[model samples]
Target: DCKKAVSGKSFYAMEGKPVCPKCVGVDEEEEEEEEA
Candidate 1:
């Protein structure tokens, strides 16, 4: 599950979720494909 962080700007963003390195690598690949 994701946690929410309250910032001074009045916007709550998702936080405190740990991501695996493999997932990050896959996300990078997807972004590269989109840029291409």
Candidate 2:
């Protein structure tokens, strides 16, 4: 889905547009907590 992350970065390009987790309400801190 749009949540897909490239490498460890929070941004990527899709269909010539920039996509970010934050735009979809994905918190990076929460992801780190879940990973831990």
Top-lDDT candidate index: 2
Predicted candidate 2 versus true structure: per-residue lDDT over 1-36, tens digit per residue:
454545675674556666675665555556454542
* Model 2 misplacement above 4 A: 1-8, 11-18, 31-36
In terms of TM-score, which candidate is strongest? 2
For all candidates, what are the clash counts? 0, 0
lDDT of 1 at 6: 30
In candidate 1, how many clashes are counted? Answer: 0
Query: How high is each candidate's TM-score?
Result: 0.24, 0.29
lDDT of 1 by residue, 1-36 (tens): 423343332332225455443333333223445543
lDDT of each: 0.36, 0.58
Kindly give the stretch of ten consecutive residues in candidate 2 with the minimal lDDT sum.
Answer: 27-36
What's the residue-level lDDT of 21 in candidate 2?
Answer: 58
